[model samples]
Target: MTPAAVNDADIHNKLRKELAQSRVLLVDRHPEARNFLRMTLSAVGITSVRNAGTAHEALRQARNARFDVILADYLLDHGRDGQQLFEELRQQQLIPLASVFMIVTGERAYRRVVSVAELAPDDYLIKPFTADQLQSRLLRAMYKKKHFAEIYGHLEDDAFVDALAALESLLARSSEFALDGLRLKGEILNALGRYDEASEVYREVLAARVAPWARMGLALALRGRGELAEALVEAQALTEDFPEYLAAYDLTADLHERTGDLTAAQETLLAASGRSPDNATRQRQVGHLAVRNKDLAVAEKAFGKALDRLRGSSLRQLDDYTNLARVRIDKGDIAGARSVAADLRREFRGGKGSEAAESADVAELAALVVDSLAAGRTGDAEAAKNALNAALARHDSLANRRSTAVSQHLAVDLAHACLAQGEEARAQALLRRAAAEHHDDEGMIDRIRGVFARAGKEHLGEAMLTQVSDEIVDLNNKGVLAARSGDLDAAISMLSQAAERVANVQFLVNAAKAIFTKMNRDGWDEALAERAQGYVRRAQAKDAASPRVVSARELCQRVAKKYGVQLESAAKWKKGTDSEAE
Candidate 1:
C-alpha cells in the first residue's frame, strides 16, 4: 500500500477475476496495510474480500459468514493473537478445516506459537515482502490445498476408506508432488489400518530427522509385531522430548500393558489424560482403565466428562458407557449395570447412524451380558441372546461382515450363561468356538481365558492354551524357514495363513520380527514378547504352572531371542548368528 506500489484499480481487477466464486477474509489493523493487501490481491485478479479492521471485527465477520480463505495478521491490535482467533473460529465451525490460513506477520512470537499448535496455518510470511514472494507462497499453498481438497473432504466426512483412496491417488499423481503428499498420505494410511504402507513411509521419513510422529508410528507398527520393548523405548524417548505429543504417552501405556505392567500402563494413561484434558478419546481410555482396576469413582468421573465433551461427535464409542457399567457391576450395583445396558442399547440402536454406529447392536448385546453376568441370571442371558439374534437379523449381511467382533462376543457370553446353568458341555462348546474366533484379538482372548481360570477349570484352560499355542507355533515355523532363506513374501504368505487358523502371541511376534528383518524399521521388540507372555500367563494365573506348557514356552522364547528380543529381562539372553535355534 506504498505510493510506489501498483494502483488499487489494477489490483482490484485482478482480485475480481481470482475470487469470483471464492469467499476470502482479510483482517488488518491498519487501513494502509489493508489497502495494500487488497490491492496486491486485486492485482492478482482475486476478489471477494470481506475486510475486518480488528480482531473483534474479524470475530464478528466469522460469526456471520463462511470463508474459503482467511488472510489475517499475526499480531492484531487486540487481546487475542491470530492463533487464538483462528481456533475460536474453528470451534464455532465457521471455518472448515479445508480453508487455507495465511498469516502476514512481522512479529517473532508467531513462530513460537506455530511450533506447538496442532492445527497449523497453511503459510506465514513477513511483512513488506515483494509481490512476487507473496504470489509464490500463495500459489504453493493453493496448489497443496487444491490437490488435497478431495482427501481432506473425505477425512472430514469420517469416510476412512474414501480418504485413504484420495491419499493414494494423491501419492500416484506424480513425483513432482509426491514428496509433499507422502507424509499426509502415510498419516491417512495409518488411520485406515494400513500399517505396512504407513511403515514404509515412516522409514523413508526417518532418514531425515527422527520425526516424533514417524518414530511413534514405527513403534505402533512394531507393537503390532509384538515388539513391546522396542516400541516402549521409542514411545518413552519421544514422550520425554515432546511431552506435548500426547500420542506417544498413550502408545506407551499400551506397550506397558502388553508387557503385563498394568500399574505402569495405568499411570501412563492417567498422565496422558491429564496432559490432553479436552481430548474425549483420552478421557474415555482413562475411564476404561479405571473400570479394569475396579476403581468405580474414577471410572464414573472420566466417563461422565467424556460423555459431556464428545456429545456431538458421532465417532464417540460406547466403550466409556460400557466401562462405567462394568464399574457399577463390580461395586455390587446390578441395577445400575442393568440401566447402563438399557442405555447402551438405546444409544447404539438410535443415536448411532454411521457404519461404525451400525455396530451398536454388538454393544447392546455386550451391555445385556454385563447386566446378566452381574446378576448371575441364565434366563436373562437367553433372553438377551434371542434379542441380539433378532437385532442382528435386521442388518443385511452385517453379521457376515463382523465375524470378528460380534460373533466372538456372542459365543463367549453364551458360554458364560451356559456355565451358570450347569450345562458344562454346552459351555465348553460355546467357549471353544469363541476362543477360536477371537484368537487374533489378544485383549478379548485374554478375557475369555480369564473367565475359564476364574471358573476353576484349570485343566480345560491349559488344554485350550496348548491348542492355541500349537496352531501359532505351526504357522510360525512355516515362516521361520522362509525367513532364513530371505523369502519374505513366502514368509509373509505362510504367516498370514497361520494367523487365520490361530491368533497366538508367538506367531505374531515371529511375523513382526519377519517384518522388521525385511523392512529395517524401529519400534519396541520386548513389548511384543511381553504381550505373548501375557496370553500364556493368563492361562495359568490361578493354578500350578504346567511342565509341558513351560517347555513349549521356552521354545517360543528361543525363536524371538534369536531376533534381538529376550523373552525376559535376563542378562544371558543373547542369541548367536545361527538363526536356527529349535
Candidate 2:
C-alpha cells in the first residue's frame, strides 16, 4: 500500500497542516488505503486527517467537517461510487471555496466515470501510481492553494489589495516553480494586472511547448500592451492548433473589439459560445455584446441561457444574473426584470454565514445597484449608495476590492444618472473620472464610449479607450499634483477635463476622488458640487461605504432630491435609458 519513494511522513504532515489550517476530508473503503494515506500524510509532517470507509460515513464526515481537500476512491464499497459521494458533499457546501479536491481512481474506472465537467476534480491520481506523483500533486496543490486562497478570500472579503498582493507574491516567487508552478504563476500574475511579467512567463513556457493557456495568456498581454493585431494573429494561430480551446476565441474576440471591429468580435464570440454553450461565462459575454449592439433577441437568448447554465462559481453566477436582468429589461419585462433583480440580489448577498459574510457584502451592494437600475427607481440609488458604503466600511479604510469596485461603479453610475437627468457635461466629467480610476474594466470603457459618441465627443472616448494602460498611472500622478497645489479648482477642473477627455472610468474616479477630497477641505462650489455628486452617486451604487462616497452620501442625496431626479442602478436599465447612457 505504500507509495514507492515518497516519504510517508511528508504526506502525513501535508494532510494535517492543510486540515488544521483550512479543511481536508479523506475517504477510502480499504482499511489499508486509509492507513497508508494517514500514515503517509503523518510522515510528511501533517498532524490531522479525517477518514471514512463507507459512502454514508464519507457523506457524514463531509457534512460535519469544513475541509479544504477531499480524497475519495473511484469505487466506494457501499454501492455508491466515490464520485457520487463527493458530488453530494459539494452540493451541500461542506468544502470552502479554497478547498483542494482530488480523486483517486484505478485506471480501469476512467471510462466508466461519467463526463460531468461541472464535477471535474481539481487534481486526480491514478491508483498504483508512485508516491512521488501523489506527493508532487499535493505539494503543488497546497502551494497554489495557499497562493490563490487569498484571491478567493479577498474576492469573498472584497479586499482587492490583499488579493492583488497575494498574486504579486505568487508572481515573484514563481521563478522557483518547475514547469507546473510557472504556468499557474503566470496566470496569477496576469490576474494581478502585471501583464508584462505574465507575457514573459508565457514566452518562456511557449519556448518549450505551446500550451493553450500560455498562448492565451500571451495574447492577453500583447492585447493589453496595445499590440492587438498581432495578438489576434497569435490567437488565431493557436486556435487552429487547438480547435477546441475556447479561451482562444475569447482572446481573438477581445482583439477585434479593441480594434473597433464589433462585427468580427460578435461573430468570434458567437462561434465560441455556440461550441461551448454550457459555459455560462461565454454565453454571458455573447449576451453582453449582443445587448450592447442592440440585438435584443440575441442578447435575451444568450443571457437567458447563461442564467440557466449558471452552475459555476459564485461570482460568475452573479454576473450572469446581472446581465440576465439587463436583457429582461430590453425585452420590456419590467416585472420580470425586477423579479430577476430580486433573485440576483439574494444570490449576490450569498449567505450570512461567517465564511460568506465579506462576499455577501459585495453581492448585496452590487444587487442594490442592479435592482435599482432595473426598477427605474432612482430612489434606490440612495440605498445602493448606503449598501456600498456599508460594505466598504467592513474592510480597511483604503485600497481594497470593495473600495475599487465601489469607486468605479459610483463614478460610472452617477455619470449615467446625470446624463439621464439632462446633465451631459456633468455626466461626461464623472465618466472621465471613472475611466482614470478603473482602467482594467474593458466593459465599462466600452459603455462610456457610447456616452461620448452620443454627446458628439467620439474622438475623445476613442483616444482615452485606446490608451488606457498608459493613462492610468499618469492620471493618478497628475491628479495628485494638481490637488497638492493651491489650485483646488484648477486641480478639479484639470482632472475632470482629463477624465472627460477619455473613456477610462478608473481614471475619472481617481480624479473625482482627489477633487472631492480637496474640495471638502476647501469649500464646495455649485458646479464642482454637481460634478462631485455624480461621482459620489457612482461610488454609492457600487458600495455605499466607499471612503469618499460614505462621506458625501448625505450631500448627494440632498442635491439629487432637490433636482427631482434619482440615479438609476447599474444593473437595471430600459432601452431608452440605455440609448442615452452612451
Candidate 3:
C-alpha cells in the first residue's frame, strides 16, 4: 500500500478502538429508529448507548451524563427539530464543544439542515444509509473533534489568548481543518473586541470561497467595530443569497433596530419567523418588535406561538405568558387576557418548597397585572386600582431577583398600569428605572417609549429617556475622568457607587476595572479585591459576554496573578449555569 493509504488505515484503526469505548445518545421520535441505531452501534462494538424520544429527553440525558457522541433525528417531536436542540444545547453549554453532534435527516431536508450558519452540526446522515456509512462519518467527525480538542479546551475556560495561541499552532501546520481553525480564530477575536483582526480573518476566508459563515462573521466584526452601515449591507446580501440562513436575518433585524428603524426590524423578524415558526426566541423578538410598532395582531400571534412552543419545556419563561397577555390587553380582548392570566396561574401553581413559593409569588405578580388590565377594560375602575396597587407594592422586591429582560418587562407592565390609572408620577419613576437599568438596550428603551405613547405622553417619555441617558453618562464619566487624572481612589468610589445604584453592565464593569487598577497600583487589599469581584459578578450577571466584562475579567486575572491570590473560576460568574463558557 502507498504511504497515504497506510496512514489512513492506521487512523481508522485507532478510531475504531476509541469508538468501542465511546458513549452515545440517540434521539429520535420513533422507537424503531432508536432501536435500529442502537443495533448498528452494537454491531460496531459500541455498547454504551442511551435513547431519547424527544428533544426534552435528549437535553435531560445530555445534562445528566457526558456523552462522546449525540445522534439526533432532524424531525424531533413537539415542533423542535434537531438543529434547534443542538443550538439550545450549545447556548446552554450542556454539551461540550469537543463532543460530536450529528443530524440524521431525510434527503428532502438535507439542504435546509446543512444550511445552518450560527451553529452547524459536526456531520449529517441522510436516511437509508448503511451501517458502514454511519461508521465512516462518525470516525471522520471524531477525527476532526480530536484535531480541535486543545482549542476547545481554551474556549471552555474563556481563555481567548490561549485559544488564539492554539489556533495559531493549528493553522501553522496547514492541516485539513485549516478553514475551521480560521473560523474559530475570527470568533475568538470578535469575542475579545479585536474587531479589526476578526474582520481581516473573515475577509481572508471570503477571498478563498463564498462561505456563508465567513460572510456572517465579517458582518459581525463590522458591527462590533461600529461600522453599522457596512454590516447591514453585508448581512442583507447574505440573506438574499441564502434566505434560509436564519441568523443572518437576526443580524439584519438587529442592525435595523440599532439604526432606529423599528418598522424594518419588525418586518425582518416577521419574515424570519415565517420561515421558522417554531423558534421561540425569534418569535419572542418578533412579538416585542411588533408591540413597539403598534402591530397588535402580529404581536398577539407571535407571542401566542412563543408561549405554545415553550409550554412544558425547561426553556419556558414567565415573560412568554406575560407578553401574550399584554398583547391581548392592548387589543382590548379582556376575556383573552384573563384566559392567559388563568393559564399562567395554572402553569406555575402547586409546588412544595421555598423555590416553588417564590415562583408562585412571581406568577401571581404577573397575573395581577394581567387581571388589572382586564379589569380596567371592563370598566371596573375600583378593581383595577386595587390590583395595580398590590402589584406596585411588590414590583421592586420581585424585579430585583429576575433576569434583566424579565425585570424590564415587569417594569414596563407596571408602568403601563400606572399610566392607565392616571398615576403619572409613578409611571415616570418606573420608566426612568427601566431606562437606567437597560440604558444600552434599544429594545427595552423602545418598549418604555411605547408605553408612554400609549398613554399620550410620548414627548415626556423622550425627555425622561434623555435625562436618564445623560445621568448615566455623567456618572460613568466622573469615575472615568477621575481615573484618567490618576485619582484611583475617587474613581473607585464613584464607579462603585454608580454600579450599586444603577446596576448597569457598564457601571458594574467600570467599577470592577477601577478597583482592579487601584489594587494593581498599590498593595492588594483583600476587602477591595472582594468588592471588585462582586462588581465583576454583577457585571457578568448583566452581560457575561460583553467586551467590557471580558476586559474587566482579564484585568482581574492579571491583578490576582500579580498578588499571587488564587481566584475562583470565571465560569462561576455566568448567569445561570456553572458550566464552561460558550
Best by lDDT: 3
> Cα lDDT of all candidates, in order?
0.60, 0.59, 0.84
Q: Which candidate is the best by TM-score?
A: 3
The Cα RMSD in angstroms, rounded to one decimal, for candidate 2 relative to the true structure is 14.2
Off by over 4 Å in 3: 1-17, 112-119, 396-406, 519-534, 556-582
Off by over 4 Å in 1: 1-113, 116-138, 144-231, 287-313, 316-320, 348-364, 377-414, 423-434, 437-440, 472-582
Determine which window of 10 residues in candidate 3 has minimal summed lDDT. Answer: 573-582
lDDT of 2: 0.59
Model 1 lDDT at residue 450: 57
Pairs with steric clashes in candidate 3: none
lDDT of 2 at 54: 67
lDDT of 3 by residue, 389-494 (tens): 9887667667686632346687789789889899899889878878998998988987888888888989999999999999999999999999999999999999
**Candidate 1 Cα deviation (angstroms), residue 215:** 5.1
Question: Per lDDT, what order, best first?
Answer: 3, 1, 2
Kindly list the per-residue Cα lDDT of model 1 for residues 383-428, writing each as its tens digit: 6555444433432245476442444545565466455545567667
Residues 523-546 of candidate 2: C-alpha lDDT, one tens digit per residue: 555666567656644454443323
Ranking of all candidate structures by their TM-score, best first:
3, 1, 2
